[model samples]
Target: MANYNPYENMLQTLDLAADTLGIPRNDYEVLRHPEREMNVAIPVQMDDGHVEVFTGYRCQHSSVLGASKGGLRFHPDADENEVRALGAWMTIKNAIAHLPYGGGKGGIKVDPKKLSERELERLTRGFVRKIAPIIGVERDVPAPDVNTNPQIMSWIVDEYSALTGQWTPGIVTGKPLAIGGSLGRNEATGRGCMFTLLSYLEKQGTSIKDLTIAVQGFGNVGSVGALLMHREGAKIVAIGDVHGSLYNANGIDVEKAYEYANSHGRSLEGYEEPGMTRIPNPDLLLLDVDVLYLAALENQVNEANMKEVKAKLILEGANGPLTKDADLYFFEKGIPVLPDVLANGGGVVVSYYEWVQNKAGFYWSEEEVNEKLAKNMKKSFEEVWAMQEEFKVYPRLAAYMVALRRLVEALKIKGYNG
Candidate 1:
């Protein structure tokens, strides 16, 4: 409903970050544009014998640090420019997380909910076939985003392997554990979000048990984040998905809601519990809670509804949840936002570990993987927090500073820019 362009949002953030750093425009102009953008048409044969062509886009924003790394989203709103913006964010995210990778993103313009399982599989294979030439273990690796999941990544890995006549589990991440996936892969993002939140709370001298949380999106990230927060003694008073939003004055039993939604194919439409009242999803955003988690689609928090936000802290569990204009609005209100790069960077952090394991032909135990991830995430968080304090800027811009600093170094070393 908002006339926001995500790419323009990204550029504004980049421009502000550059201005804060006082870097000349000529030094980072190359990063303002993607290195490569590929748009392809996948014509698939439906079970009814009709040919349907779906538009797909893959954008490699940068590769100076390492192979291009990002997720593949399947949604009706996906477009070339959106994918381009997401790819650019991927680069910034990896850099801020201090990962040895660049950024890329791809998406297909179709609502997976409208397609049957067979049709989804066919479309996945078709997409893999189309993009196989540009993606691989040492090249651009794709993971799951939006409506896509590990099963979709599995299909891509299988289809790409079939085309190349080899087994390369490293070619794709977020795959099921049966196919060389890493331990703690499923809950990595949510768990990492919890970790970062706790870490920030500790730094702020606030007790997690005393806070209230309102999560917008009961999907993988939000559900797990809410559940984890509940376990930590935080009261979850509001939650919502595409179905609707639900609130309880006391607290909704997150475990029960998760079970109901999981058994019902990830829908919270008819979920019933004591003290539960149905409300609009937008209303959930404005709920009075200490922590507001955005785990839904992009533009969920924008300029139009920015005035309604009531949370003191925002954890971006989803990518690009806050547009630039909305972010500035929140910043002016003294509401600190933990950007997606620093919050949701956990998933890709562990994905990089998975890739290393797959390449070395050895894997780490769950404890080892989690320990390594925690170390990396904590380090990244500390760096961003320090940057925020030093620059007297918002956390999002501080995160971009962390990433841009690293990226400029990489570019200098690569001789792309001096």
Candidate 2:
């Protein structure tokens, strides 16, 4: 992999996109840095009477468009730099989707799987209590990511509301539907990714059924992405998760894998079928698939493995999956990569819808949510595609340019410079 740091790698792309747009340093220099960063120490009482202190971070990258929006991740590898980069990505993602919001991100350093259910609940509440001062229905909104889910968001809503003595579900998104969660929010990211890919293919006169897809990290994003592609008649040749990966040339039943992971507590360990062969995680990246879906961690497609990636297109289901060097390598190879900002913007789009519904006391049906998502994703893909064609640059850079241009225009309209 590349030796470059994740934050620095993101900066490299940002600088290039800024240069491509010819934006002056004075115009977006502030965008290069976060608006605020809060680091908190969360102490949780374990069932064994042990007090373990965990480090947590909340970074607001920008609020020029509107309130900051992003997700909170619980992982052993969560760090300030990763949180910062992810926060910045949320800004770009929202702008690319044409949402009226900037970007923020939160994370806690813990292996969530190691904690008991009670301990997990306690930790979630503790995080909300610590960040309560800065987050709210109109401030920074937090969603789910990585080890976080709707349950965690429900805890956040309950803690924040109990502290303030009001029922404010808008303070968080991705909650359970029984609460104030939006319909179609769970599958929004993957569905958005597929929609963008489909739009791109349509412009190129290609179809999904003609593609062979290999997906990495079969979590919420990957599993859903593979299933959607399969539904569209694509051949899902390989898939993987945190445990490992599996491949089959004829196609590895995505429906079977999805059911297996669901029943087996979100795992793919014992998945099997005829013609299926288990492969290493990295091997999934090098597979000779038409489209490679990356829904795992960042820096997965770094310099070390860039040369081995044989896919014609890369759909980033994870933020910052390809390092700067790897991104450049793909550009040199003429491989089209739909950057995470545009590829995985579905979650934030629906999150915005949820916020709107909460504010207006009206909700949309699942069909309405999916239809609106498709419309926005199609428009974004077309804009980015046009920028790519006009600038003769990579898709990621083009996407950044599209988002940056919109952000700069918004800043100008708001008279921020004055």
Across residues 280-322, which tens digit of lDDT does each residue of candidate 2 receive?
Answer: 8889999998999999988888768899889999999999898
How does each model score on TM-score?
Answer: 0.98, 0.98
Model 1 weakest lDDT span, ten residues long: 409-418
Evaluated at residue 354, the lDDT of candidate 2 is 91
Which portions of model 2 miss their true places by more than 4 Å? 1-3
Model 1 regions more than 4 Å off: none
User: Candidate 1 lDDT, tens digit per residue, 116-139?
Assistant: 899999999999999999988888
Per-model RMSD to reference: 1.2, 1.2
Candidate models: Cα lDDT each: 0.89, 0.91
The clash tally of candidate 1 reads 0
Alpha carbon RMSD to native, model 2:
1.2
